[model samples]
Target: MRTEMFVDGKWIGATGGTFASVDPATGEVLAELPEATEAEVNAAVDAAARAFESAEWAGMLPAARAHVLLKAADLLAARTAEFAQLETRDQGQPLAISAGFSVPNAVEHFRYYAGWVTKITGITAPLSVPNVDYRTRREPLGVCALITPWNFPLMILVWKLAPALATGNTVVIKPAEQTPLTTLLLAEVLAEAGVPAGVVNIVTGGPEVGKALVRHPKVAKISFTGSTAVGREIASEAGRALKKVSLELGGKAPSIIDADADLDEAIEGNLMSGLLNSGQVCAAATRFYVDRKRADEFASKVAAIAGSMKLGSGLDETSQLGPLVSLEQLEQVDRYVQIGRSEGADLLTGGSRADGDLANGFFYRPTVFGNVTQNMRIAREEIFGPVLAVLPYDDADDLASRANDTDYGLAAYIWSRDIGTANRLAHQVKAGTVWINMPPLLDAGAAWGGMKASGMGREMGWAAIEDFTEVKSIWTSLA
Candidate 1:
């Protein structure tokens, strides 16, 4: 299928050129999408700005906005399978994961945020002067720019777009060029659900489309999810324009397996958590911390489960793991494995590509490495593969220190039987999201974001909805 850019509530051919999205499985062209130019990006932003400034939208009550948002949510939930299949083909995430996990997560974000469309509240302040009465009212931030990554395209798209729209702000989204099909399709869902034209739009392309949107004067705020390097560029541009920015960047998250933890349960969670989506997830648990006594046992179990995982096409009924997003990513993962071996980390299991039998697809065997130190290149950097680095620790304090040593802290996992210890360690770790015995993604109402180099700003929940809105103080005098 050929896809086009959404501008001013209509799908039109790109003025610049056309680009093809390839299926990572066999390197076949899945679809052709527009290479949006500077002009097209600016046009989408201008349309969103005009929509925001219009009395038709700006003057409407919160209830009216809520009605539209909820309607969109219902339509999205009904069409979950269609979006999930497209996502699996384009992004290389398993159809089961995309359908059972990502699509539903996206729909929840819409339905939950839909409820908040009319409930935005502001506080009343005590006045110093008796002649004046002051109160606050929340208003939309006009135009918002959303730039989502290739991994979990539909889910991350919801994370960026839901609150921006639910709070009554108009938005122009720039989904990753590699996998923008689901998002461009989502624009149709919004219209079908009753969201007005110009309220939402999708522009897809590489760096230029992203750069143009970020630097545009019409875009009041930007919310992005991608690599740390690209996030830096976007943040710098936003700084230059004095525009608001929210970023959910990269991570090399660590999971600690305490001595008092359930070894079997921990091993199971560790194996499946990172292997989900073939470990392309930003918050994927890549590093495993265990007591010295349990390191050997833990490594064996992790390797066994990983070795047994069914690897094939995302659409395969028995496939639990899928290919990486691209052949480029497969090469990157292999290079990192080589780096680990050269750095003296023991290759416990899976050190090569699975191209022997799966020659037609981009497939790498699930990898596990042992005898890893905190200082190794493999442990420190993000491999973005189905690779695990199991590190041994002597004490809890030492484990905590080592876990915090990484430059990225988007998410962390703790597998322990003791509630007190889990709660205590959870407080010490420097991550936006900390999981205790659970490695799955969270609900739509919880605030999800990262700290440090992982980027800033929170999305979801009541507070996150407010992130898309601006509060104004109104003062009146009654003489």
Candidate 2:
């Protein structure tokens, strides 16, 4: 893997020194990556800004821009296995997931946005004033700083990068310090795909680099995916500079298992959605609200399924779940597990970290807490781990209200045989995305974001194009 930062289309070493990129599955240092200081961050933004204003990129036709993205998609698809392995190694997700979901999704984002490049349009307005021709133009925002989280490193990077590039905006990306390898690899892919020099720049580091990127005056927009606390800070800083910002932040998504729901399907769906990527997803269904009548049975099956999951190295094809991103994450998840116990929630199956053969890695057992109240921290806070808090709901009428009680409203899941009831609850829920009788599946065409503290703006589909571009009104005298 490339250890240096990619700035202005050139690879350079960092002045801030290097840090070890440890593999979470084995607690092994995979590579040492250069940490970007403020100097490097500024250099990246400067490159992006210069590229944004350059004739090579800025003057390219929509079709030509789309070609670059499509070529990148083809290149990525051809190297799926290579990218997936690196993603699994860097991010601690199972190789199956990296290959099946993450890498494929990244490819789809590129292709999807490539299609949208020519479709981005503004309307000509029929004005009240006579002899005046009025129209609006949707234009690129220029020099976007895309900050992605450790959980879904390469996929989420493409989530922001695809749209920014589709809208003709240059970007400076800051992948999470824990998982920077795949992003670095993608820089090579973008460059090889004929993306102009400096059109896409990458600087890898910790929070200090992110702060510098956000504070850079040349950055016209900021697209972030991570914790809500950090999102709030970025929003505040971007607001001060009056830069456009889109944040896909933390989520405490609730999954509702209604009385009439198919029990088998609901249990399996919950297991997959709640435990996928070891429950590191931002829109993960961490909170489950079951009808009181079936709560006991539902919790039992979920606990059994979670317990049956195999914890091993992400490179192992048979491993259903892998380790947390780091020891720090593992400790945080365990701390929340303890908090759940103190709040009187019952630990149904696994609670502590994994032992025996997996002792060296940062693996936490897939845990489910029963008898969890709405007031419990596990049910309220965003615990980005493979831990589920199942809460019982006494009435169907109160289900939506109870699920919406948390500060997060990113995504929610509802399982019901009755479409009317499912649709009703889906409408009642305040989250940005809601699924009925299905596991959490994302599409490149669907709008993904949140309500309330979860986030500020959407990331996928046309909404993403809007977020990355600006609208300008123009009036011409026809008389």
Give per-model TM-scores: 0.98, 0.99
The C-alpha RMSD in Å for every predicted model, in order, reads 1.3, 0.9
Q: On residues 277-296, what C-alpha lDDT tens digit does candidate 2 reach at each position?
A: 99998888888888888889
lDDT for predicted candidate 2 compared with the true structure: 0.92
For candidate 1, which ten residues in a row score worst on lDDT?
55-64
| Model 1 / residue 305 / CA error / Å | 0.7
Stretches off by above 4 angstroms in model 1 are none
Residue-wise lDDT of candidate 1 within 364-476, one digit each (tens)?
99999998999998898988889999999987877778998988989999998889989999999999999899866689888888988998988888767777888899999
- The Cα local distance difference test for each model comes to 0.87, 0.92
Residue 18, candidate 1: alpha-carbon lDDT:
86
